[model samples]
Target: MKQLLVFIRKEFYHVFRDRRTLLILFGLPTAQILLFGFALSSEVKNINLAVVDFAHDQATQHIIGKLQASRYFHLQQAPLSYAAMETAFRQGKIKAALVFPANFSADLGHTGRGQLQIVADGSDPNTASTITTYLTAIVGDYQRQLNQAAGALPFQIVPETRLLYNPEMNGSLNFIPGVLALVLMIVCTTLTSVSIVREKERGTMEVLLVSPFRPLLVLIAKAVPYLVLSLLDFTLILLLSVFVLDVEIRGSVMLLYGVSTVFIVACLSLGLLISNVTASQQVAMLVSMMGMMLPTLLFTGFMFPLENLPGPLRLIPNLLPSHWYYLVVKAVMLKGLGFGAVWRETLILLGMSVALLGISLRNFNIRLA
Candidate 1:
């Protein structure tokens, strides 16, 4: 018990003494939470829109008034020609353009139909899709109101929408869990790798090796402190996501924590393997940045859709622990799934932890011999 306490104390000292590691462990999580919550949002707001109104009628003016008042779109340009609309979009001044055909109100009044073309910049598919949906709903609602005022039209199509799981479509609920996984990877893996290599650089690892403690014991001693710290950081992140960001965990909290624990173990083991392979602190830092951090960020479907990535790039996430963690987090947080829903991911994380531990042990023994 005394030896364990001493080991833990030493580990804490190492962790706290380095300002960079401490900041990455605690500061980075909060930064990422705020960034993804506010700055990096998929929700569209204040989008600039252009109008090419060939039909300068009272009805068209009324429709444009409703659009400008709705607050989702801003009427940035009222172009006289399609060429002007094209120029505005090409200059990145507007996201969408609405064109009202000539004699729009005359056609609607006589034949009960009119043509309105909406041309969107398809370069950003997400923004375009959202804008399209919003426009459709607004137009449909306006048409229904007009019909009701005109004594009930013969044609009526009622559309009922039911959003599954995330009824509110809160992006934070999806984003927070992914950010948690990413921050934990940086904290556990990069920091651990650097800490272990620091020991080698300072000539402390050799001294510890000469002691009676086994290599496995030393490894555990180093990792256990980080595990505790990670759990504490996890709780902080969870609380911030819930109370501050208004993100909810639909599944059992205990189950989420259990899966998170498995993921942290896997990440820490990978860090340990990295520590064993690298000889110096600089090499460890470089390897952690290049080998683990880049792959974890790019391939984990955090910022970009995995399906949109090329085949070769898609295969890269298969080898990353963050990819598995993202799946588990999405299941628990967004889908309200339990252990049964994410058993495969949990097993993959466990298998990865075991494999990394085995490799680290083999390397440690070889170095000892």
Candidate 2:
């Protein structure tokens, strides 16, 4: 019994001595709680909405005021024409737009009937559906209030909804892009992160460093195989998504692959950086999987509505490469957008690839202790 107690004490000392183990014990739980509490929420808020009130009357203004006052949306002055509104949707300026006819108040007062056009960006069918539901409720509430004020009159404001990009509101279309991001991150980052670390475990890394090949070539050689493999994995995922899931790619296939290739590179570079910093294969694997998986899941915006996150928490997703990749895929595969639509996200992924690769190369030690 005394010997067993001594052994337990020794184990505790070893755990506290290792910073990584200590972190895994205490820090991991704390971080998970904070991330899940703050970021993982289905209750939507701060939807980017545009209001076009051609009527510009007292009634229209009151409804607009209520929309902005609610926690659900932040309102913008909508574009003048339908074409401009379409441009706004494509540019991701507004998630949904409410268009009121010029004779809105006049019709509601005299005839107790008016039409409202609710246009939503439907690439993300879930968010689009939620936005439409919220708008319907708000309009219904206003209609009920008007009826009460007018006494026995049924004052109705009807909302006519149109969903752009995905009129059908397919559920699979919403998640496929996110699944792509998660799969690529796992295959590319987790696998590549352990490549160099495995060499250290087997004591073969020193031989590669001393050989005729340059350090850069050695790193490239380690990454090239995974890069090709990740692309193949992406292609396979795309095929299954199209045939099995019935969510077809709407944009150029070449462009989709082009952007996916960039994202894979970014993920690979991140993995290489992990391999460079970590001392052991086990540590590398843990960091690459646990450290990365949470961010990928939370920050990618596929798992939950990012707008629901608090202001400071919202900025964290922009740091994740998967988030950009998800956006690009949605624009290309789901929205049928061209290179012009996804160029910004593509550039961001490319920049992340460059930066991560550069840092990995800089920190890579030629002389390992």
Against the true structure, whose lDDT is highest? 1
Encode model 1's per-residue lDDT on 70-140: one tens digit a residue.
Answer: 66789985989998899999999999988899988899898888779888889999889888776666666
Error of 2 at 33 (Å): 27
Work out the TM-score per prediction: 0.83, 0.57
Looking at model 1, residue 189 earns an lDDT score of 85
lDDT of 1 at 167: 30
Which window of ten consecutive residues has the lowest lDDT sum in model 1? Answer: 158-167
In the order shown, the candidates' Cα RMSDs to the true structure are 3.6, 15.7
Candidate 1, position 148, lDDT: 78
